[model samples]
Target: MEFNILNQSPVLNGHSVEQSLGHTTELAKLADRLGYKRYFVSEHHNMENVIGTSPEVLVTHLLNQTKNINVGAGGVMLSHHNPFHVAEQFQLISHLAPGRVNLGVGKAPGGTPLATAALQHELRSDIDSFNDRFLSLKSFVDGTHDNHKVLKISVDTESSKPDLFLLGGSLSSAKFAADNEVNYIFAHFIKNDENLLKEVASAYKELYPGGKFIAALSVLLTETEKEKKAAKEENSVYSLKFKDGRTLRVTTEKQVNDYIKNTDEKIEVEKSQLDMILGTKDEILSKLNELSNSCPIDEFMFHLPTADAALRNLTIETLAPIHTIHKEKAGIL
Candidate 1:
């Protein structure tokens, strides 16, 4: 029952700009009112289907409306943007939200390789430099470091760095996150191994010295049985796209089903390889509790596909109370 809530800023294809902005703002207000801890938007670019290319802009809009909910990138894909620019944007967010901001950084390129290359074409593509970039970003925001004297993130505050989290789905990322003292956010939706969650969490803790490990899950919660089943069916399709956006078509379920069935992979084997789940609330909560206890995460971020406001709201409404109770019992609330 004791955990933090992180709402995903998901995007859809059908909405107008006004509708998208309005829905996101509404979710932020609702999250604040519901006592959810933070709302994080993802960075996606050049995808005709996704609207979250500029999470900082979205964060600004949401912060204007919500009084309590912390808003920032559920992850800002560092691979695409300049570290300094990212820092400044988040610094501005921190200035606006103060103690209620977080900056979760992802090393993975969230878009197509072509798009990734295009985004980073001007910058060095040294993945190893992420560590340096992260350090530089922190220094810029924190206004610290003797060797490097840089402009403070335009905020002039010592604590403007905001809370930081290292996010990834691979074992390598878990190791790196642990090696560093930063918090770790395992994206379970992309790498959905429940056992791996426990393994990685333990590895992170062992190597971490101290700090929290956050597990993130992408889920859909439904009401009636019919609705639940329908949601599950729909979610399976959604999960396919989330996991692998390479599909040529979006409207065809047959393509997804065929892709799933024809893969040289067995169902269990493939499921283990994939990073998310599509199931009813009962099934979802069961797996989530397992990951929480097994991974012993300090917090859990729910990536509610933001396109469906109703389903997303229902997810938070139903799950927040349980998370709160669990947190209270565990003394984490």
Candidate 2:
């Protein structure tokens, strides 16, 4: 198994942006020292709690801070920018840290309506142009755009190009990724549906035939007695089904409130036992072994979403993969 950390650079209560950013940097260094494979930052806009608006900038700073560790975006929303510009930025990053950058792209807005409008001001058709945007981005990276006339990604022949990945929680996205023949990361933390994951995995494998697939999920490794009890409370997973057959796990009350505040989608709620693995080291290991045996997941990416920064850092330290298999190349493949 391969292990990597996905950081949101979360600003917990009473912590300033500088402190949160500093803490995240320290954690990325710790990950490198502990043999964690990669460090990817999340992206959000107009989110006071989530300060990572520009993943490209974060990747560059982290690349300067760490050596021999891969740094990339958890994703840059594909609809937000021109494909050629996005390709050029990451290609330059590859020059800075050759063979150590991954470019994951998603279709999510990564922000509220106002923020999306502001960020995507010139590209007004982003909402309905995700597939087209990805195709163009891929063309630019693969040096097939304009019949090789312009905007070619100029990476060294010996070095790996910026890895391109499509990230999403929906099967529609999965099929698109497989059809396009790029890597894919399934966000189980967003939907928490194992059957859905397996369904997409099967389809993607059959369509792409030995392509890379990453399963990104959350982890909560607690030690204190109070922490154990509190972690269980966080596992009270609820599902809200919308009229358009869209369903997502509502992990926090704020998510529910935001849904109600933003849209008029009539929701039918369903409560179920949480399927995630979260506990002490032994219990979590057992669950991991079982998952590895039962599922065809290529690699597991862990994200700790706790507001308690100390505990979050501790979890990464304790779960550091001292024994996971290492690959010669940089990607999940």
Among the numbered candidates, top TM-score falls to 2
- What lDDT score belongs to each candidate, Candidate 1 first? 0.66, 0.78
Can you tell me which runs of candidate 1 are displaced by over 4 Å?
A: 1-8, 11-14, 124-128, 144-146, 237-287, 305-307, 322-333
Candidate 1: how many backbone clashes? 10
TM-score of each: 0.78, 0.85
lDDT of 1 by residue, 80-127 (tens): 777777888887778877888788897665554456657777875455
Give the per-residue Cα lDDT of candidate 2 at 143: 81
Clashing pairs in 2: none
Q: Would you list the clashing residue pairs of candidate 1?
A: 1-323, 1-325, 1-326, 1-327, 2-326, 2-327, 189-275, 190-275, 191-275, 192-275
Whole-structure CA lDDT of model 1: 0.66
Model 2 residue 168 CA deviation (Å) reads 1.4
